[model samples]
Target: MNEAIKGNILTPSGWLNGTISFGERIEDVAGSSSDPMLNSDDYILPGFIDLHVHGGAGKDVMEGGDAVHAIAAIHARHGTTSMLATTMTAPPEDIDVALAAIGKAVRQRGKGEARVLGAHLEGPYINSGKLGAQPNFARAATIEEVHRLEKLAPMRVITVAPEISGHLELVSDLAKHGVRVQIGHTLGSYEEGVAALDHGATGFTHLFNAMSGLHHREPGMVGAALAHAEFAELIPDLLHVHPGAIKGALRAIPRLYCVTDSTAATGMPDGEYMLGRHVVHKCMGGVRLPDGTLAGSTLTLDQALRNLVGLGLDLADASKRVSTHAADYLGLQDRGRLARGAYADLVVMDRDLKLKAVYIEGERCDLNDA
Candidate 1:
């Protein structure tokens, strides 16, 4: 069935006031020629594509099976049309389970759930020194292990520490197989980060969280990312980064995007939750380890949008941060814009940036269902 919705439709050029007709893809977007400043009412925009997400709704991606469905359902309700089923630094068996399950979900995504783009193996090849909230499952990257995992399921992205032994070669190999290599959880300096990018490390995971910090003489991963990395995912829940820093990143890296490093505790009440092999306590609107290092988060993408808006970004740029940049980063040509023939994955929000409705593949979602 064809469907049409009227509102201030956000397009790549700017805001358009009219109706969008769509089915599986956008059939047409008839915008009002007389463009007035968009009001603070029902605004239609592209659905968010989260490149990094762990789990939500009390289910971890490591749980596998229906856990992907649960996580997708939960995020779909919050306006994420698609996401990577991000994994943690776990043992080989655990990683295998997560990869298999994520591949299955990608092959057979159901209705009423966000599309699982693929698996983002966060790490087994990261630096143990900078493993923020990740367990002690750190190891060096090896071609044999990478091949075995690829055989199990398609690996869309993998995070590595450039300083890790034998990882530069692994980065080149992973890139050869069309996997996006992200640098993270490392104490690597600017030189090493540049080397990784030259070897095909195209992105940085949760920038400034687990990687080395910037200094005057020896700008580390953070500096390298801000200055040279092609893409970087940021946690903009306010808890992960300061507003000033977020703005700085936005100014520095035009391709910078937002990601919810959310955990199983998301959408649930304050309580204890598992992050890989460690236990994190959730309270006071934050998740943390027993030693007080910040864990993941309980943030949803809608709230992330609100945070950007609160930080004084206009709607279009905020939408780009959550949708366009991520989609482009993953090379998803079908989404992230309200253009004709794009996937009809969109979000509806009131003036206050609150989620009013969500549509994935042109099907309306029950926001209250998850």
Candidate 2:
């Protein structure tokens, strides 16, 4: 695999006109090249890192196995070179099994994204009050539960309601193990939000969705997430969040990371879908429940990239959000950059922000390419 993969490289630092070489192993990358490259007018950026993604291309992480491979390959086509296979709230035992199975799949990586960094368990211990669309059976995580699950995966992240019982202690415990605790789907008050943040809770899950609403005087969860600018995840599919709110939140949380909380229905046909035990309908270009509760998004990373730029986000910032910002969330130093030594995962997109090609460790991928 000694090939120079060249493109209009866009790093968090800025864009560069050079070639990046890939070696056989994960750490190998060529630093310099003298060959003249072709003009693409394309945005060649680091391959996207989606920290929170359930399943796509008709597979769910909970159904772990070849489905993991199938869905990941599908998403890589959309430019996600790396991701944390997110699982929905489910029975504790089921969660453990799913985690273990995914751990194996990732260790023996075949197809799909170049790398499966780890697993993101959305919850088993979450506040039932603001569960939003998360399955009801998998309740919030307790301190005892965290101790068990953290040992099951390489990387771990969870979305919790800070107001739930054992929430603070759980955050502290998880943090001690290097597991990132995200605040979301919560009904916590503004003060509670801050309190949770104090416990080394690095970021928010999906801001302004399942959590408490905003009140000028009270300043609920949204207020807390916005007021704390260091970190928060935004599902900028325009459907999950309003365009204006997306722009405003990005402004408020200067270090906002964009994600697609997309489900198995993402690349599938518009029809019936299942999110945990709930039967969801993928219609009108978005997934929804019987009462029209927005289930998941149809927006791809490219769409969100365009959305961010449309909302006045500069290339560098948007590039960071889609790349290194996510890596930062997981504390991964190797990815999210186009430097000489970073993993050679890359994405090439047109000016209109359409994904044309994706490379994982210098291997060209994009299911449609075949």
Candidate 3:
């Protein structure tokens, strides 16, 4: 499986105008001027790692079967090398079915698909008042229930409303078990958000959406995260959060990463699609519910990078927001960087940032079928 490619390779130290050699893992990254293969005008950067992905390509993860594989393959075409199969809030039996399907996808990653790292349980333990696009199945979480679900699949990330009954303690317990807890879909106050962080919740889910607002007097959950959080996820589709607010978050949170938060409408034409238990319509380049509330997005990571760059972020910094910081969030050291001894997961793009090629564990993807 040994292979090599030459371009302006991005590494931890900086960009190197040279060649990178690898098998399943990178073996070497060296700068050279004389190699004929280095003549291509391309940029080599780390592949994207999306932490919040529900579904895509007209298939919903909640469908629970080979649909996860279809979603993974569609995202892989868009340069996502690894992702979490994010689950929406559903009834217990439905959630179990979805988790079991994701567990299988994690165990056996299909060819030409993004690596399904694990599940991101984003619901069922959130506030009923702020159930943005989520069904009305919100309830308090129990440690026993979480433990049983984890047995079906690794819960890499879980979103909880700390203001819910006993959820602060649950956050601490889940953190102790090495799960990355996030605060979202809540009506909690600023003090409650801070308390969740003190209890070991490390990140905020989709900052500025479905959470409390940031007023000068109130300083709600958004304010707490803006003031104190080191890491948070923001959907960069330009529709979810305004570019101005995104800039504010960028100035505030040091490691503000991007997530697709994409639904089954992604990679498909404008039409009706399923997002969990609700049926959403896609039109005017956005997906929405019957009441015109934005459900999920059709954003892909490649477009997310372009959107960030369009917002005046430099390419390198934007790449880190889309790739490096997310890998850092999940403590995955091997997947997000292009360096020796790292996984050979990378994306090749032209000067315009359009995807040229993608590699996952040294296997080149056929973008024609993407």
lDDT of 2 by residue, 1-370 (tens): 5666555666544566655566532342333332213454566788888888777777777876676777677778888888888877887776877788678767877754547778877876677776777778746456766666756766567887888877898888788888888988787999999999889788888888988878999999889888984878889887888888987887788778988887889788888877766778887779888888887665567667887888887776888888888888787777877766777777777767788777887677745742
- Please give the lDDT score at residue 247 for candidate 3: 97
Cα miss at 209, model 2 (Å)?
A: 0.7
Model 1 pairs in collision: none
Candidate 3 lDDT, tens digit per residue, 184-219? 999999999999999999999999999999999999
In candidate 2, where is summed lDDT lowest over 10 consecutive residues? 28-37
Model 3 residue pairs with clashes: none
Against the unseen true structure, what C-alpha lDDT does each candidate score?
A: 0.90, 0.76, 0.94
TM-score of each: 0.97, 0.92, 0.97
- Residue 247 displacement in candidate 3 (angstroms): 0.5
Total clashing pairs for each candidate:
0, 6, 0
Cα displacement (angstroms), candidate 1, residue 202, comes to 0.8
